[model samples]
Target: MFRQLSERFGRPVAMAILTLLGMWLMVMVTLPQLQMIDYSFRPNLLPAQLGGPEDVWTLSNYVTLFNNEIHRAIFFKTLWSSVLVTLLTLVVSYPLAYYLAKVATPRQAALCILLLIIPFWINEILRTYSWFIILAFRGPLNEILLALGLIDRPIRFLSGDGGVMVGMVYAYILFMVFPLYNAIESLDDNQIRAARDLGAGNVRTHWRIVIPHAKPGIATGCIMTFMLAAGSYAVPALLGSPGSRWFTQIIYNWFFEGGNWNQGAAYAFLLLVLCIGFMSLVMKFFKVGLGDIAK
Candidate 1:
């Protein structure tokens, strides 16, 4: 009877079962995060005293968020840094993806793609630490520059915004590349040939034929890279100095070191909500849904 019902449902029953299972898994994993969310809304002061019950509910956490300019600045700074990193990734990955898709032979394309994957095989912390060595004051880059007479002293790259951006771009390039590659691979090469055959110039052919087709992947890559970059705590904390700290670093500090989970949760939820809003805005502007990109 179950088999017959599943067959009659035409895969939907299977999907529904899987969906429910997935939701259950997600809820289980997220229970602690949900507790944190609940914790964020509680009033920290004037609670558990003066006959107040534990977990006193209040909106002051969020209200304090709105009232605090420093927190707002951190949020916007993180947003901007993520945006910049995503844009840089897209710019760097696009031509590489285009070449791999349109020009490179199968063997060569496979090799290039392999190079991108090679970095991930190493521990991510190892990769970030490797950059620290390269970018540090007494590192090889500085030595070489000194040899070349570029400067009298070592340059400061490991503890600045420049180092943070570099680390972010390196870490997130694969996210940008694979999506663009997929989009470009799915494009009908015949249409491009047709455009060329009709005397359409390269610029015209690309703008009229390729750009619209690849829009979904562009959107996907940007959204993915931006979200990951913005939420990353390790890269920023490792590479950046106090003045250049990313907002995730701030949230992590508040949560772990400061022992103020309420503020931390507030910060985290704001970041989450902002990311959702960014993706929604992108989808609306591009007229493409996440499902469209999945194909």
Candidate 2:
């Protein structure tokens, strides 16, 4: 990799790039992870007694997570909710991606992309708050339904996880769309044309040709969407009702409210494990290798 980079750029520039990447891996990723793992193993202690005998390593934190029924339920709920969001996002994104990559002209695609990006230019917190406003019982959506005589009264959209789901899908669908677009854009037009000429229908063409070629993108997009939704704090905190508390909220409480950093680290470590396990499952189901997605 270094040799290829050095050839493309200069040796000095390549070395500089390599150095920056190394620093990022160590400082931003590896060190923090090591610290979290270290914290997870030790007992939660008073600040002054952190290095005292009472702070000895133990499995109590991990064991507590499994033994606590409420936390365990929250963890599973977060996992299932993230999976649902990922699947829903993929369903919505694949057609839009196909339209932009294969159906629309370059100018049209650019315009569509610009429209999509314009909303994201706003801060994510502001965007989530926008959903919170839109999903209130007397909000525009309910008013519209009432005006159309579709309903006699306002639906309580914010009474459950529905608002949070809407926010998560809205926030993360872009992640799915772009990957699918890039993969589909790289496909040869001739293959699609040839398939049609041989009497293949749209479903058959996508099932046999397009989908197989786009497996890596599907895997990457699903992984990204699921992880983002599962690890999400802001959207859920804003849109979720009391009944829809996410696992991350529990982790936050453990760290800040409970003043138990060890337990928080353990919970966080479990969430990380859940995400990695989900990623592996997606890759296997798609028959995509890590190298394929990297490409």
**Candidate 2, RMSD to the unseen true structure:** 2.0
For model 2, how does the per-residue alpha-carbon lDDT over 40-88 read when each residue is reduced to its tens digit?
9998888899778797889999999889998999899999999999999
Give the per-residue lDDT digits (tens) of candidate 1, residues 121-233. 99888899888888888999899999999999998887558888999999999999988999988888998999999999988987888878888988999899999999997
- Number of backbone-clashing residue pairs for each candidate, in the order shown: 0, 0
Model 2 residue 4 distance off true place after TM-score fit, in angstroms: 6.0
Taking all chains together, each candidate's TM-score versus the true structure is 0.87, 0.94
Candidate 2 off by > 4 Å: 1-20
**Which residues of candidate 1, in runs, are more than 4 Å off?**
1-5, 8-23, 45-54, 148-153
Roughly what TM-score does model 1 have, to 2 decimal places? 0.87
